[model samples]
Target chain A: MEIIISILLLSGSFFIFLSALGIIRFKDLYSRMHSTTKASSFGLLLLLVGVSLFFNELNVYVKTILVVVFIYLTAPLAAHAIAKSYREKDKE
Target chain B: MAINNIVLLLSFSFLIVAFILAFVRLLLGQGIYNRIAAMDLIASIVIGFVLVYAVFIQMGLYIDVAVIISLVAFLGTVAVSIYLKNNTNKNDGDNH
Candidate 1:
């Protein structure tokens, strides 16, 4: 179980590391947003699942799950909002 | 347990490296939008760091704090977006 948890966490960290890479490598706003949103959300999902699974207590698991859900809901919306602003700014 | 510690250390190192890269990108961004995107990435990476630290230390408080940080970070991004929108529109109107 510990091994499984560690692997999950490490893989998640790798995804986030890639997300950071994307932020640096991508030239424009849209591509950067695409990389940041997808990679980070997936990374966060994995990390939350790994941590929650390791904890036996019910509430901790529940809280982590809620946090995951929160990230899922907010990430895309925030991305959209920022992208829209970028577009609007561009039109000017 | 020792292996787990080593794994955690490696993960932390990766995150720190990523964070530093993102910070450099933020500094070098050509425009305000790029800067904002880099800033957003920075916040997410920091949240990732906090979370791994929390789990490494087995602290419940850090979990809650992570949640709060995520929410606040989201709010900040939205606020910046709105500010950018208004700023652009105002500039356009002034030019016209």
Candidate 2:
């Protein structure tokens, strides 16, 4: 069980690393947002789940679950707003 | 125990790599939007790192910190987007 948890966490970390690479490598604003928002959001969610899995304590699991929920609710909207602003800037 | 520690260390290293990637965008980004986006990405990653750290260190407090960080980042992104929108409009007016 511990090994499984570790694997999940590492996978999440790997995806985060990939998104970061995408942020640096992508040519433009929209594409960068595309990579970072979705990839990192999923990565963080997985990481949080891994944390909950590893820590059998109820409070820790609850907190980690909250973090996951918070990210889910916020990340996409933030990225969209940012991208919209950038597009508006381009039009001007 | 040894393997777990190694995995944890590697995850931290991955976070560092993410930071470096964001730093590259900060330095070489073509525009203010790009830089701001990079900053936003960094903030999100930091929150993830905090959550992971909380798990590794077995602390519940860091989760609260992560939540606070997320809230701050959301507000910061909104403010920045508004400012960027207004600033660009002002520039357009000046050019006319």
Candidate 3:
């Protein structure tokens, strides 16, 4: 159990690190948005999973799942809004 | 026990580094869009931080904080985007 939790947390953090790197290194605005939205969402998923496993309680499971669902739902919407506005501004 | 502690430490360090990188992008990014995207990324990183801290201390309360932060971040992003769109339209209208 300990090993599993540790692995999940470490990998999640690594993915987040990757997301940040992409934000800094990606050349184009759209590409940077792409990197930030997808990678970070996955990273958060992993982190929440690890937390759920570590706690192993009903309430923890529920809250973690709620957080995961909320994040997955909103991250893309936020990205889309930003991208749409960006393109519109660029057009003008 | 020792390995778990080390793993937690390492993951926390990773998150810290990620936060710094995102902050740099937010500060130095070229355009408004770049900064907005970086800000979103930073919010996600902060969520990660909250989760890890919760695990580290074995408390469940912080997960609620995570949810709230995510909510705020989403709303802020959408609001900024809407404002940007409206502001651009106003500018174009004035010019034309």
Instruction: Return the TM-score for each candidate structure.
Output: 0.95, 0.91, 0.96
- Candidate 3 runs further than 4 Å off: B1-3
Pick out the ten consecutive residues of candidate 2 chain A with the lowest summed lDDT: A48-57
What TM-score does candidate 1 get on C-alpha atoms? 0.95
Model 2 local distance difference test score? 0.83
User: Model 1: iRMSD?
Assistant: 1.5
Residue A34 shift from truth in candidate 1, angstroms? 0.8
Clashing pairs in 1: none
Candidate 1 ranges beyond 4 A from true positions:
B1-3
Residue pairs in candidate 3 whose N, alpha carbon or C atoms collide under 3 angstroms: none
**DockQ list for all candidates:** 0.69, 0.68, 0.78
- After superposing all C-alphas onto the true structure, candidate 3 shows an RMSD in angstroms of 1.3
TM-score of chain B of each: 0.91, 0.88, 0.93
With candidate 2 superimposed using the best TM-score fit, by how many Å does residue A81's alpha carbon deviate from the native? 1.1
Query: Please, what are the lDDT tens digits per residue for candidate 3 over residues B16-35?
Result: 99999999998998988889
Model 1 chain A — which ten-residue stretch has the worst lDDT? A48-57
Which regions of candidate 2 fall more than 4 Å away from where they truly are? B1-3, B94-96
- lDDT by residue (B1-96, candidate 1, tens digit) is 323788899889889988998899888988888888888888888888887887888866777877888999999999999998998889888999
